[model samples]
Target: VTAISGSNVSLQISNLSTNYEQLTWLYSAHQKILEWEFNKTNLFKSKFKNRVSLSGNQALSIFNVQKEDSSTYILRVLKESGKEEEWHISLEVFDPVPQPNIEIQKKQEVNNICHLQLSCKIPDQSITYTWYGNSRALAAGPQSFMLEITVNSENHSTSYTCEVSNPVSSKNDTVYFTLPCQLGKKYSWGWEGGHRVDEVKKDVGIL
Candidate 1:
């Protein structure tokens, strides 16, 4: 059996002996009769039913089918001597399930640098990753699990989330960071600054 077109499938059988004089094809769905072709044209078609064709040369083609329509196809050939040979074909369709996983790490901490290293752990099946803050995407990224926040002041007290998705499913994770920045005091020079400047100048002149 071979697929002749996107919507069509072809089954071929060969016979070297003159034993078979006639061929008949029959099909069923969930054990219910759906189509039967006997000594007719090579093709069978119906708008309300699936498209199946039988050629004069003992080839069968089924088209426009769905997963639920899959079943076993039985072909019988009758010989001129009143003997018959039978063959069977089974059809199966499959689709993959989408993978799900978390996008970012569950917790994070910010340092005095006001920077943070955020991470996400996505399921191995995920294909892409998206990070968001306040419902906006974090920008360009490739994978779903691994990410770096680059640690910035804006990350403080912000509710960040990572959303991971693929063709079939999606998953997400959120974390908040409150960065601790310790401010230092700046020294100011007054009359002390003027006295220090004069003292330094006098010492330099004396030397």
Candidate 2:
């Protein structure tokens, strides 16, 4: 069916019989061919000599698979009693997922609870989304494209990240939320040269 790049994959044959006169492998897409008989295999096409192989059970093994290797493969077994059997297998390869974009659609505070909503901008429906809070994984599943979280004053200065991924690759983006900073002021008096008094002011910011 499907395989990613740089991975090894094999196509297996069932009901194998040792009485076969010869086993042949034909790559329908590139016109590459191979034949095995009497424990000896004849390989054609130098391009596939190192990556393609036929096992003892007539299985095809492809090593260090690449995107260009996506094609249909056919295996033909010639029996000693003058009968032939064939197997067809299709392979597909995909690239890694790219970085994702996140949007903060809405944020509102009701009573003492803040409601935050977010969405992923990617259009691929097959991709899955996972939510994390301060590097801790949330209870999320594959269908959670949109997220709704409720935060209170206890959760101020928090961070949330969304990891979008598929079977081959993953990417993520993060957002931070901060509470309103508290400002304070203090006033003090200093004596001038025994006649007048000067005033000084100080301001402080606390989170």
Candidate 3:
């Protein structure tokens, strides 16, 4: 089974007969963590104390699990009939994903032209990304975090957010792009002193 780091996990141990006389819990790193013999409980001195307990059903519960807790757990049971049995389990733990980092690759307005490219950085591996524009879902489970945007006067004011998620957790980071409307060209012609006069002007440069 798999679980997120810093979360609680329960290792079920059941189906033991009343003849069970001894039991021991073993970890990959440490040998013996807890044991029971002669109808007595024995807890070894380890870093897992205060966070590990056994339930009435003999289920082992580990709290505040950490990355190092990912390992093999072996449970040995000895029956009063001079027989022994072992149960094994494998556990995987992962860290929660951090908030995504938003980077503006391109932001420039020249000659009334603007272009923008934003990047949503994935801080860790095994994570997925999603993009939202103006509170609307734009992309789902995007493999890449780079977003090439087409900024228009009406849509430039739109807001963009990137959500980074993983098996353990999800987080969102937002970015906004506002662009000015492009200016239009105007031309005028008049007659001055019986002479034809023409004037032309263009406006398009603003941030």
Candidate 4:
């Protein structure tokens, strides 16, 4: 079972028969969590006092799950015919994925083509990143957080999206780029008799 942190999770008991005499929930090896006998339920672990409960069908429900709650749980059932059955369940909890932030690492224009390098920022390394262009998936790999693209007059105003996801949650962010390759110009301004004057100094170069 996979669950997100600060969420609720339920571990259901499958193939349960209605003729069971007793039911017991154990944590790890021998740490008892709860026991059901003679139509009465008793909770054994103080740590799960107000955070754990059993449903009508003997399914275990945990509230406000945390990272420390990831472990193996066992359920033992005793039938009226003196037969015992055991089931082992493994639970894994993960933090929610945060919204991805895209940053431009480098941008330059050469021969009317804009070359750009973008990076996706996130603190967690155990997640996957996917890049999209104009709502279509890019050619980058699932683990690639860096993207390099070239923009020209045909695709100057293109939008890119970065999606970050884990086993339990996902988030995405988008960025748009407008590239206009033209000659760079410089301007000079001066004040003469309380009047502002402006003039173009010179053309720097193609940018």
Candidate 5:
């Protein structure tokens, strides 16, 4: 029950020994499959060195194997009523690595200073940076920076971060800002009209 079809690996032997007399396979740990089974048994010492033959063309096809070619297969069927049957196969290999993308930026309006922004978009390459606040470690700028907030009268609320890594993959982003207020209405500075002493003496007040 060995299955992997991309690098090639398929072993299905349901008792195949109907007058067959040779079969071998191994890859339990790789050594180049014992140097490809000693160059296909050239040293001639038939304990099936490098394990041999999966078929001689009677419905068994083994071709261009890879994925370490897996291991554990032995079949030496010598039947003429002298009976012999041995079969076993086990191989599993897979490759996968791709799933990373994180971006964040939300902390707008902080007069007197206060800003935090970060970004991370990975699909191909070019990523390696780290910055975290509230989680500590914040001192590595390049992707973005302009934080200088200083208008907190004290109430506690300050955090900023931006961490993105690369060796394979990593992502992070955070933004925070505090200190900017206008609640209802506190704006009064005008000069739309001057004093009027009886409407400013009928208009003598235009100086």
Candidate 6:
């Protein structure tokens, strides 16, 4: 099972019979997390402290989970008939995805074709990025963070979205190309004439 960091997660032992004499939960097969002696007392590990709990239905819950809590857990039940049953569960914890930012790295018009280079501004290399145009997926691969595309000047007024995701969460941001890519049009970002400028009008002969 996969869980987001700082969230609560529960691992349940389903169809547990009532004829069990003792119930125990182990971490990584050796470390005992908790044990319940039937009708007697419950013992919990000091490491877990107040962060872990066992429900009446034999569910193990952890609050405010962290990446360090990801591991394999085993639930062992000692039946009254001298037989033992076990259930194994694996948990994976991942950090929540941050909201993505789309940046125009380069944009220029040549011969009526608008060339654009975009990037998803996320520093994490473990995350995957996907590009979309007008709500449709682009040709960029699932793991690509940079996207380059060309559009006719007449059809350049569209929106492009960048989605960044991990195993547990996803976030996306969009950039709108509402202004025409005509000569002398003003742009707030991207390169012009091999120099970086902001909120400037394009020159008639610059690319």
lDDT of candidates 1 onward, in order: 0.46, 0.68, 0.68, 0.74, 0.36, 0.72
Q: Candidates 2 and 3: which is better by TM-score?
A: 3
Supply candidate 5's per-residue lDDT for 176.
40
Screening candidate 3 with a backbone cut-off below 3 angstroms (N, C-alpha, C), the clashing residue pairs are 112-204
Q: What lDDT is reached at residue 98 by model 4?
A: 60
Off by over 4 Å in 4: 139-142, 155-157, 180-207
Q: How accurate is candidate 1 locally (lDDT)?
A: 0.46
Q: How far off is model 5, as Cα RMSD?
A: 24.0
Where does model 2 exceed 4 Å of error? Answer: 99-161, 179-207
Q: lDDT of model 2 at residue 66?
A: 78
Candidate 4 residue lDDT tens string, 1-207: 988788888998788888989999887777888989998999995577788999998999989888788989999999999999999999998887665666668778888888877788677877778878777887444568998878797875466777777777666666654443332333232222233434324444443
Model number with the top TM-score: 6
Q: For candidate 2, list the clashing residue pairs, or say none.
A: none
Residue by residue across 1-207, what tens digits does model 2's lDDT show? 677677888877677778888888887834656889888998887566888888766788888887788788888889999899877888875545555555667777788777777776567665678877767877466788677877788874366667776666666666655551221332333221122234444443322
lDDT: worst 10-residue window of model 3: 184-193
TM-scores, in order shown?
0.38, 0.56, 0.65, 0.76, 0.22, 0.77
Candidate 1 displacement at residue 172 in angstroms:
17
lDDT of 6 at 165: 72
Candidate with top lDDT is 4
* Candidate 3 residue-wise lDDT, 92-162, digit = tens: 77777664666668776665555667677775767778877766877766476887756656556356777
Instruction: Summarize candidate 1's per-residue lDDT along 1-207 as a digit string, tens digits.
Output: 322113445655665254566666656422322223344444233331446655555567567545454557767767779887777777553222122222233234345344334555543442466767556777435553554545456544355565654433344555443332321121111111112211111111100
Q: Which is superior by lDDT, 1 or 3?
A: 3
Model 2: lDDT equals 0.68
lDDT tens digits, residue span 39-60, model 5: 2422224233333333333222
List clash counts for every candidate, in order.
Answer: 8, 0, 1, 0, 3, 0
Evaluated against the true structure, the overall lDDT of model 4 is 0.74
